[model samples]
Target chain A: MEFSKPIKISRRHVLKMGVMGSAALSLGIFRSQLVKSKTGSAAGSVAAQKTEQIGFMYDQQKCVACRVCQAACKATNNWEEGTEWRRVLTSDKSKAYLSISCNHCEKPACVEVCPVGAYTKREKDGIVIHDAEKCIGCKYCMYACPYHAPQFSDDTGRISKCHFCYERQDNGEDPACVANCPTNALTYGKLAELREAQGGVDQLEGLPNPELTKPSWVIIPKKE
Target chain B: MHWHWMIIIYLFLGGLGAGAYLTSFAAEKGWLGRNSSLRRTGYFIAAPIVAIGTVLLVFDLGQGLTKPWLLIGLLANLSSVMTWGVYILAAFIIVGLLKGYFTLTNKSAPNILTLSGAVLALATGTYTGLLLAVIKAVPFWATWIMPVLFVASALSTGLSLTALLAPLVEKKSFCEGREGRAHILLIVVELIIVAAFVGIMISGVNGPVAKESVALVISGVYALVFWGYFIGLGLLFPLVVYIYRYQRSKVPVIQYVSESPSATSDLAANEQKGHHSYLTIVSDISVIIGGFALRALVILAAIPVWDGITIL
Candidate 1:
């Protein structure tokens, strides 16, 4: 049997497709704007005004891998043995060291995947915190986090991670890690200001994609 | 990532129990032919198997035993896959027990009840896979194929468990009839799906972690279990046994077309009595072993995306 020719598209068909595509694109844009405006109304505006998304700023150019941040985090949280809330992973290919803890993400996976609502991102500051009292310790959050931020402790049978030193921040003090960093590599501030100050480069070598959780972090890449 | 053997056994049992319930439901609905022993055995074992798995799951949790009330928190997050699993598992266990009860009491269960239970069984089966797939951190488990492969494995393993228990349930030869054919088809499909799963992941689309995961299973640490136990014993062994039995016990075409219905049935019964022998039992056990190995290997070989990176 002979094969049939492929279906042909004429000028009229092309014009029709173009018109339909343009209409759909315009409708989508209009709908997005409408939704945005609706969500930005009085109550939303007020909520927005009351909140500032907190973020971390790290300068890889200055970190000496001394792990003072890690030590400070451990001391601040008083975490059990075998739990490192903040870890410094050195790059194999380079001398760069990434001192990381929970990014306190805008799209925090821990908040989304914690079955018992153990983890919550505060509306006022976007600081993600874990309530150990509510944790069932299923550890789904550990697997959900692209950054592997949530630490599971067999000793406590619960999950915990960087709380961004919320208590200290509320008391008008820098986080223990930030305050303890001798090189002034670690800092904290409103995410927008941090991004603006750090040139908006949140991702570094050995770090996960910033887009995954929209992590409230900014990093200054190490000089090669 | 510390899921270990407890989660492996839990996932296997959950899928197996769901699969067995489905297999029995299919039999009861006459989709796999009338085998009262098969139906009863499936109903009897499904709920208890799932219940045991649930217990293991709970026990694996940090405070599952000391503060069991904390389990109520599992229902708090509608977005969490584990929350969905809690609901599915609860409904499945309830309906599963009810079905078993009706079967034991010799009462005909309402079609609605059986149908919903079957649907729940399916959900339970699919949910086990979906639970892992939804985790974005583990690139290997993030694919849609995980659920498909899991469903296939669950069905095959469920059928294997039912077949393994059928003879003991009735103290007769577990006749390798239509069930054998179905088993062969399921195994083949499972093999294909496994291949596709490995192929897609290794093709480098999912990410480097996914590729590393495939490497771990294919030729890395888990390669031994993946190839030796899962492929050789679980899939191929049962497949060969079923195919051999099928070839050995082909009823003559003339006998099937016989005018005397009683004679034909008598011959069929006698043939079935000799077919599913002790060899079939061993094959079924191999399948169960393979199922457990499959779950363990998948869990162990999953290299999380953020394990560490070499490049800037």
Candidate 2:
């Protein structure tokens, strides 16, 4: 069950927004897009450009609950000693491990709640990026995100979270966690393709329903 | 998880300030009929109180500030709940100041201006609730009735403050009379709304999460606070006091004559005879303290039950 609501653009609204953007900029507003589309478009298009959903696929059965992804993320990102962007959550019985990072959601609450417009879903790709410079460290994003994606960075006193490894992808590499997954349980590809390849879903037994933000990822449940 | 005592404090103060403005506005609109003291007290207290709340929010956000010159994150985004809050709060403060200044100077405030300020106060109260209600994460806060509950609570707390403070500035009659009953009515409504919020959460699709959250208040670690501090002292005691004192005349029948010196002087003379019962003072104090406890209780108990984040 997808928890995130998808954005719909009738082509007219986008054009109207484009016109408004240019008009404002010409008037010396020098402003970035302060408001993002709530009904986030299914395609990862930011502006006029069309983009595909580069999604993550996680398999529960072929896995051991390893902290390698967390380690790799820290090492690769050079995050502070005690700071972590991704975390491992387990059930009370420890029957399974659910690794959580930023969902890079379609209608991200972090972006919506950030007072300074610090979070942006890159138009070229749909990567939900957090610009460190613009962050006011209110932790409102932490409160708003249902999945608790944003982690408070004590070092900087600002909230930090995963950005789908935008830098790595730009450098023609996979995310630190997915690349370092020794079990080969983590997969990354086009979202539509991954859905057909595996019976991927957005909801699970104990996790927050992903239908709220329509997380741009899929998960394979354990075999019955 | 971080303990957001600051947020809780802000919530209480915001409700108090906004609720005062609303109740006062209601009096000014003639909804309460001739309680000028209510209007004056509300106008006087709202600006500074809300200003303090806004400042608290700023410092809370200032946690990550590296440079003092950043001017405290004034940047606004329409999509942000905080951003909307900043605007609404600013509007409230501005209009409140104008209305207050004009009224004090004996300049008549147009109905439009007064109406606008009241509307803004209403927004301020509702937005405070919306901030939490929109957080789909914490199941305890994710309820439809949150906005309504907060508004009612805000009114109750706000009116309670006005009653307590107005006695000191003006005559005790306003606080001791029908306005006191109105304050009680607001509290009663707030209690009912809170029950409805919990009831809906437990009975609806959110039953599982809501039940666990409710347990924290009913039988969990915070049970003592929820029952003792909030429900018992804040709500029940005040209610009993209110019922006992005002059982005879449900509606205060004194005609408000601001220009009638004879009536005003008579009230001042009557004031020396202890016009407001001690229990009324105790009830107002209970409501105020109870209101603060109520915020703290729910917020403290509101730790989301972490079931699991299923990636598979």
Candidate 3:
């Protein structure tokens, strides 16, 4: 199918113009840097030291489908009654329950789709959080999330979902959902350590829902 | 199934419809007299409609309202349509207000201002359809033809509104010559686009999403809105009216000269033509209302409920 000329022009022209404009602006900065170097002064400061890394690890086999985590999420966040930031989905036929929340991916779709920069991923920990104040409640994030994790609150009109308990983690405590899990199914630790401990899912086990968004969780096969 | 999406869709369609009509109206009226009484009325009416529509969109976003600044400040994602839409609509409101102000002051408006506003209005009017079309996941909305159909709907609705309001604001009588004919032609085009869009949607239902969307639009809850309003009243009825008028206008005149062979006949040709023009204006109003209804229905029906569906 033949595409319109205007589409091609707009796409190419906008990009070219943007690059040219940036190059000119950066040239000015580069000349100023050279002047600063002549004066024997550093143009920039050193990067900050790395902080503690925070993330989640879910043991699917240990999850009894009791959903205490879901309850704990609501209680901790004081979210509206019907809103569930953390949802527990169980396949009765397979006797497996999966607790799904925001994966806080290296690249988050919610952050990408938000019209207003209401959604953000922390560079330090890769934790995605919503700033309700900036939220226009467009709900584009809901469609973008492969996990279907984000939930819109009717009372607030803004998108509300799990923040992985950033506050609790800041205080050196596990997330409410992970802390309250009875069977130790949920774990919170450094992302690298969790990856090393569980070794990622290699094959389908106990009705694994492959369609689930690349969750940060590790699934251990349930023992018969 | 959230009502907020419905509100967002309504605001988008209404603002675009109002903005496009105002732009076309201003363009038709010379730039010098852009703030004339007719233009003033159009802008005055349109500004509030768009402003109120935007407010409705904000209200739909919900309460916590923490990061309202994200829209303007940090969260402007150029890649996403929603982000662009927010910025475009925001620009529309700003430029529209400035245009209104300049008109009130009886000053010559800037060409760039009017042109940019028109372009933004056009983008705002059409992007909603494109937003849905880009989503490969939703079969019903994934079509190259959707954006063109949206543009047609926008023009149809915009023209309909101007036609409906013209008699009240402009001194021109409803039943007259050129303007009436243009209105009729626009409605005809709008009807054709809607037909093509629906045709494509129904014919391509190989996937589950496609089948579900088609079912929803044709036989499900959307049927009343699509068929009852968009198809039945919006397109079909307007086509019948335009055709009937065209036929009457084209009919060969059968004049019978009785006693005096070459006597001057005062048949009042202009007066009869005026009557048909008035009918055309009424038809334009019907088509515009129907077009608006179609846009509203399409938006509400297109969004899927992402409750249990796992994203791969």
Candidate 4:
């Protein structure tokens, strides 16, 4: 009868119990915040938003190597001479006229490599913007961009690239390059709408041989 | 004068400084327990140098204000060497400070923290080479051994600087003992590594890019600096001095905690305190200067010359 009962708690037992209790409390708080924040943000955004298409489509065959778009971009951005944000590249394969510019990628390499967090992606419109003041001119982003979108200005030692004319877009105006294109090769619209209206890459004619860099450019091949 | 060039230089300098500091720190705390003062000085100087180097990089970016956050927010990108480099540099700065404090206080830093910091420093130091090497666009920089070469260069430069400064920081007598021996050993390793690195670069003559890079380094615009500074003065001169001293039947007399004060005083009194020979000082300075030149040249030479060449 005297040896009937014993109660014992070790340090390890106490520590384990404490850890589990704290973890449970943290998990509960985290779960509640996650649910609450998700719905509130979603509801606020859904009320006034209009779906608009804003993306680029290039017709390689139609490009005449005039580089009007490149000139228009420089004028719009006020870029220094000899520093073209958009460039025209010619290779041996087919007398190809390709305008190399920022693709505004879904998974942008520049954003990933920027050491100074100067680049941001817009959630609503998928526009990638760079703040020059935040740039460290490390050129890491320059190397990361597959399209060679980011251009480093030797004068300022910062990366400069196409901003997609956010000022014009906000005012409901098209980007200068799109406005100035004579051949209508560079078209900007909502990505979803553009995807729906255009034929797939296969439907387009006179396209160059596909390379591995899966450029986001929606190309419409011209009939030969 | 491309901004990319500046960034690359910054990376090289930061990595070299961080690597040297970490290696010296390890040598100080490890079983060698020699040249603690020299190691301490190396770590202290490296932290500031790295900080400045990073600042130069950011300033060159033209958005220095946002640069810090960029480094902090996107600190993890395992696929990119540049991302890893940022984290490594950050860790090195923090750990280098703590380790310096511990050394001064005669306290032991947490084992985990020290080891992790060292590993990070090593990775950061070596990754600079990997960054260049991985860029297939620059055929000269695309070798696997580039990283090792970078690490070796960093070590040599950092140690040489440490040896040069130790006498100035502490009593000349303090540097004369076991610490000097460790410095000698490190110099030996550095020379061997430098030789191997140079050999590899030369052997790549079959590849035009590699051949061009080597030519740029050896007989081109940078030939004099490369040969006169890095090879003859930085590496060879130091090696010869180390060998001569090692052979002269003079082992450095280190101070031990167990030695009696009277005995230590007597030894100190009897010992003829020697200045780091003028040649050693010259060699050290030459190596540091040469190291910087080598890094700058590597960055410039690694870029493909044909990148922007247009055919008529």
lDDT of each: 0.80, 0.71, 0.60, 0.62
Model 4 per-residue lDDT tens digits across residues A11-50: 3443665586456445534643564466457646767454
Off by over 4 Å in 3: A1-60, A92-95, A136-138, A170-172, A187-224, B4-9, B12-45, B64-80, B97-108, B130-146, B172-207, B250-278, B303-305, B309-312
Candidate 4: TM-score, chain B only: 0.80
User: Per-residue error at B120 for model 1, in Å?
Assistant: 0.8
Residue B103 error for model 4, in Å? 2.7
lDDT of 2 by residue, B1-312 (tens): 354777788888888888888877876765554444567778778867888888777677635346433323434466766767877887788777777766665667678878888888888888888887777767788877887887887888888787677767675455333464676687688789878876776675564776777877778887887788778877888887877655534222244454353344334334433335667777777887877887787677665534325433
Q: Which candidate is the best by DockQ?
A: 2
In terms of lDDT, the poorest run of 10 residues in model 1 chain A is: A1-10
Q: Which regions of candidate 1 deviate over 4 angstroms?
A: A1-51, A198-200, B172-176, B254-269, B308-312
B47-149: candidate 1 lDDT, tens digit per residue? 8999999999998898788788777667666677787788788778877877886787676877987999889988988888998998778889989988888
lDDT of 1 by residue, A150-211 (tens): 88888889888889998998799999999999999888898888988744587764457767
At residue A37, candidate 1 shows an lDDT of: 65
lDDT of 2 at A47: 56
Q: In candidate 3, what are the lDDT values of residues A139-221, reduced to their tens digit?
A: 77776664566787766666778899988887988899989999998877776667676444512332223343334444454
lDDT per residue for candidate 3 within B48-155, as digits (tens), equals 556677666665655414545433432245567775665566566666666655555555568786667677677767676676665543456667777777776766
Comparing 2 and 3 on DockQ, the stronger one: 2
